[model samples]
Target chain A: EPEVTQTPSHQVTQMGQEVILRCVPISNHLYFYWYRQILGQKVEFLVSFYNNEISEKSEIFDDQFSVERPDGSNFTLKIRSTKLEDSAMYFCASSRVQSENEKLFFGSGTQLSVL
Target chain B: LAKTTQPISMDSYEGQEVNITCSHNNIATNDYITWYQQFPSQGPRFIIQGYKTKVTNEVASLFIPADRKSSTLSLPRVSLSDTAVYYCLVGDPMNTGFQKLVFGTGTRLLVSP
Candidate 1:
């Protein structure tokens, strides 16, 4: 079973610093997404990417956040200025197609810790 | 996306069957009920999906009634390793261009030996 892989299983950064999280989606997948979960909170959607551009984003994804498909297989999420509240588990996911019944393959997740 | 309501937590013993139910009273015509399971410190994994009636897979079974207003996820003869949080999501995949899966507070199941 092919899966999505995320780098830097854990990251600790100071406030106001810039951080970039990288992910390699399944080779055949075309839709990629980023989601985050604060400790003891529900998972929240951040953004979705397709065709080398952002397809949609949630309110949680503000100016401080950006996503890119930097290469054929790599997808990245960059935070320009991290805040303490930015500490959470960031997950990368991908789906073979944009279908109602399609299931997403998720990475183990990158734990981002902002001090 | 239809809002889903489910139990916050459940406790079961090893080798027992566990059924987690989710209520989605406002489910739309095109909405599908999908279930995901998440262990602590990991991303959610797809368990099963169903439109109506019963859908069975290797891991679990999804039962949706004729009304389609609610669904049940049944895990047969669970073991300690089956402990995890179960999420129920309702959405119309075709209409959702971004395919964003809205997750509610999932049901945490603890299977003890």
Candidate 2:
């Protein structure tokens, strides 16, 4: 089965540095999303994207964060300045259609570690 | 999004059937109850989804009550490989053209031989 693939499975960066996480969602999927989970915590939604624009975002997605679909296949999340609290497993997901019944395919996840 | 509550952990032996129940008293009319499973260091994987009554796929079965306040995930003949964390989520899935899945602390199932 096709899957969402994320690059740099592990990322380590300085606290004040910028970081960009990349994802290649399923080729035919139209809706994309970003979620994060702190160690031993519940997974939290960050942002959702569709039609080349952000559909919704959580409070955690503040001024330091942004998402871009630079091309047909790549979805990227950028943090202008990283913080210790930003460290977590970031997941990328996609669905063919955004519906109550649609199933989402998730990437293994990018483990972001801030020093 | 409706908040869900489930047991923190469960233990079962191999070949036994396992049932994990989740409570969501605030489920909305458009919300669908879905379950996902996760192994250590991996993203959540879809298990089953249902709006009402029962829905079964090859991997698991989902049973939703008429009130839509609670749902159960049933795994038949579970094995050691079935040990993982299972999450129950309730949401419109497409409330604003995208599905924002909110995962609560999931139920951890440990299958022993």
Candidate 3:
């Protein structure tokens, strides 16, 4: 089965630094998403992107965060001025369609650690 | 988005069938119930999805009643490797348009030998 692929499985950065997480969603998928989970917490939606534009975003995705489909296959999440609270496993997901019954394919996740 | 309620945790033995129930009292006409499983340190994996009635795949079976107020995810003959957290989500993608899923605290399932 095809899967979403994220690069730099582990990232360590200092507070106030900039970080960019990269993901390659399934080739045929049309919708992309970013989600995060603090250790031992429920997964939280960050943002969704479709047709090269942001479809929706959560409050957690504030000015510090942005997503871009830099190319045909690569989707990226950039966080500027990272804080200690930014430490978490960030996941990338994709779906062929944005429907009530469509299932998302998720990557293993990028573990972002801000010191 | 309809809120879901499920047990916080469950314990089972290897070779036993595990059924995790999730309740969504406010499910809408277009909402669908979907289940995802996550092992430690990994992203959630899709298991099964159903709008109503029973939907079964190679991995698990989803049973939704006529009222659609609740759904059950049945794992047949579970093993220790099956230990994971299972999430149940309810949403209407057509209405919301590119809906971002809201994941609640999922049920933790531990299968022992």
Candidate 4:
């Protein structure tokens, strides 16, 4: 089965540096999303994208965060300036639509570690 | 988004049947009950989902009562490898735009052999 794929399974960066996590969702999937889980915490929604534009975002997705689909397959999340609290497992997910019963395909996740 | 409540943890013996229930008292009519299993250092994996009644797949079973206020995930003959965190999510998903799954603090299961 086709699955979502993310790059840089792990990333370590300085507190003020920039970081980008890349993902390639299933080709046929039309919608994409980003979520993050701080160690031992619930997975929190970051943002959702569709029709080549952002649909919704959470409070945590402040001005510092941005998402882009640079090409047909690659979707990326960039943090302009990182903080220690930004360290977490960032996951990429995709689905055909927002069907109540639809299942979202998730990548293995990119572990971001900011020091 | 509906709030769900689940026990923090559970313990099971090898070969025992394990049932973990999640309560979403205010689940919307269009919401679906989905369960996911996660291991440390990896993303979560979908287990099973049900709108109502009982739905069973090769990996596990999902039981949703009529009120739609609660659901149960049943694992048969669980083994040591079955040890992991289980999450129950209840949502319409229509507004998330990506079927974005909102996972709660999952129920951690420890299987002893």
Give the clash count for each candidate. Answer: 1, 0, 0, 0
lDDT at residue B112 of model 1 (Cα atoms): 94
What local lDDT does model 1 show for residue A103?
Answer: 94
True contacts kept of each: 0.88, 0.86, 0.82, 0.73
Tell me what TM-score chain B of candidate 4 gets against the true chain B. 0.97
Candidate DockQ values, in order, are 0.87, 0.78, 0.79, 0.71
lDDT of the structure predicted as candidate 2: 0.93
Sorting all predicted structures by lDDT, with the top scorer first, yields 1, 3, 2, 4
| Winner on lDDT (2 vs 4) | 2
How do the residues B1-113 of candidate 4 rate in per-residue lDDT, one tens digit apiece? 78999999999999999999999998988887889898887778888988999999999999988898999999999999999999998887676446666788899999998
Show model 2 residue runs off by greater than 4 Å: none
lDDT at residue B92 of model 2 (Cα atoms): 83
- Quote the positional error of residue A63 for candidate 2 in Å: 1.3
Cα lDDT tens digits for candidate 2, B71-110: 9999999999999999998888667347778788999999
Worst 10 residues of 3 chain B by lDDT: B92-101
TM-score (C-alpha, index-matched) for candidate 1: 0.99
> Of models 2 and 4, which has the larger TM-score?
2
Maximum-TM-score candidate: 1
Residue A1 alpha-carbon offset, candidate 1, angstroms: 1.7
TM-scores of all models? 0.99, 0.96, 0.97, 0.95
